[model samples]
Target: MRTSRTELLLGRTLLVVALVLTVLPLLSMLSAALQPADRNPTGLSWPSDPQWINFVTAFQVGHVWQLMGSSALIVLGVVPASLLFATLAGYALGGLRVRGGRAVLVFLVLGLTIPFEALIIPLYYQAQAMGTLNTQWAIVFPLIGLFMPFSVFWMRAHFVNVPVELSEAARVDGASIWQEFRRIQLPLATPALSALAILLFLWTWNQFLLPVVLVANPLDRTVAGALTFFQGQYYSSIPLLNAGALIIITPAIVVFLIFQRQFIKALLQGAVKG
Candidate 1:
């Protein structure tokens, strides 16, 4: 059915309203970050003289470069590892019928329900006992496990929708399971995996609690985790704090901007089946 003029106008108006709601706060924060670090600016108004050096001041005082390095290392470790494991597990559960597969899927569903807050204390003690406390591994290891539920679910959703004929064709050609996965299914699953990687990278980069509890040094913390300590020290400095916040989130924004097309494609890929 063709949409009426009134419906189109209403939809556009709603979208514009939603866009303004989302962009306004970001503009306000960027505005605030341009003010002098020592001066406290209130509300969302343009600064008389933008202090570009506020970013430099925040970068220096917050050790943002070091925190960024730490976050990069963590993202490198977490995203690839999580993607690899989740892909294999998703293939097993979604593409193949294995013994006890239902039970395993149920367990993962349960894992998703368990709140991170409830597990933090136990994870802390476990890290302490394993002597991994205060190390980057402390953060990297738990993140992989915590990410498994959602990652597996995402890949499995893609895998389940894949036609069985593709797998059968590979098998008829005398291809082993690994060979089939490597040569056939994986190529078709690229969009889904790319989307998953983007989500995993953002989650790992923004992880705050694990680094805070498990890692002791501010330098060792992820950028978002380090933000807590930075805030405590510079609570009085609004400009620097806002600048630091922007620096920490910039990577995630950039990644989404770059991969947004793939991300949208992945979401829409499964929307229709022939």
Candidate 2:
């Protein structure tokens, strides 16, 4: 009983520490953003007079709405398509047991080790030859392809853990592989799919490097990518910069909040499934 109590106390203490560590920087940024835009604020000190209007001004000047739209467009394009392909590949490898699937899975896992940064140069030339540079496609295609390796691995993990009896039963009922995945395995894999969707959404929305490198037009780039251009123009206005940064992250926060229940469900489902 004493050991259990001690472990519980330690865990709770760690959780509190983590909560503070996560929240403290956000609070400091908020404090800094509330100060006058003209003066450079130091540390976490609150201003005598708060300039809440800084956010409003920053939104207009930073083109937050347009940035949001651009990001939304990219996310919609990337997430659904990536999920579909990853799901198909994962099912083939994990559920169907395709010929040479193990070797292919090894290569896909290896792809994960090859950092995105290394491929940027080759991708740049490829996009140029394809005439996609300076366009949203430049950002969209690379993100989808780059994301595949991990996404496939993730889905494969879920499908592998699924009971083989489920597929065997479906096969006995004269169901094709397609029907088995569509009707039986797919429904059971909801938690995995939902969790993967949220992750892809976040990664696609927060994508900065690919957009910056591939899309020359700032307006065509994601909000996070556009932040660099925004920073260049408003480097002197610290408050505006902080406000704009907060504005940029708001959509992601909203997304997480809206889907938080599904996210948690996925985690719990995984625990039980495993």
Candidate 3:
């Protein structure tokens, strides 16, 4: 009983520490966002009068709505494409009896090792050849390609955790391979898929380098790129920048909160079964 009580106390202390560590930076950013613009030297302190208008100002001055629309278009295009391609590839690798499946998997795993920076110059040239530069397709296509390898890896791991006997049973019932995967395997992969969708959404939303390099027009820029607008050669607007940062970060936070359980489940799935 005494040992159990000590363990409980230790858990609570650790939770408190974790919460503080996670929240402190967010609190500082919020404070900075609210700080008066006319202050002598902007420091991280609670505002005497919180300027809730910073958010509004951020929207007006930054052309935030346009940036958001650009980001949304990229996310909408990339997430579904990545998920569908990854799911089909993962199902094939995990469940099918095709020859050279292991080789394909090894190639995909190798893809994860190659840095995106190395591919950017080549990708830019390809985009230019395709007449996609400064267009939404330029950013969207590369993000889809970059995200696919990891998505396949993640979904394949989850698919492997699903029991082989389930597929066998589906086959015994006269289901075709496609039908079995659609009806049995994909249904069982919901938790992992949900987790992957949220992750991909976050990643695509936060992508800066691709958009910066591929897109030149501010009208085509994403929220990640829009943050750079607040930084100038001679002057910087820290508070407004923090406001933009908050706007960019809030959606991801909301998504993680919504799918928190699914994310945890995906992490825990294979540990017990495999």
lDDT value for candidate 2? 0.87
Q: What is each predicted model's overall lDDT from 0 to 1?
A: 0.90, 0.87, 0.84
Over 1-274, each residue of candidate 1 has an lDDT whose tens digit, in order, gives 7999999999999999999998898899899999987889999999989998988878788887889999999999999999999999999988885688889889999999999999899999988998899999999999999999999988888889999999999999999999999998899899999999999999999998889889989899899964565566688988888888888888899999999999999999978788
lDDT of 3 by residue, 158-221 (tens): 8777888898898889999888888888888998899999999999988889888999897686
- Writing each residue's lDDT as its tens digit, candidate 2 over 209-247 gives 888889887888898854564566577888888888888
**Superposition TM-score, candidate 2 onto the true structure:** 0.94
Clashing pairs in 3: none
Q: Could you give the candidate ranking by TM-score, starting with the highest?
A: 1, 2, 3
- What is the TM-score of each predicted model, taking all chains together? 0.94, 0.94, 0.92
Off by over 4 Å in 1: 1-7, 229-233
For model 3, the superposed segments whose C-alpha errors exceed 4 Å read 1-12, 40-44, 233-235
Q: Which of candidates 2 and 3 is the stronger one according to lDDT?
A: 2
Whole-structure CA lDDT of model 3 = 0.84
Which residue pairs in candidate 2 collide? none
Measure candidate 3: CA RMSD: 2.5
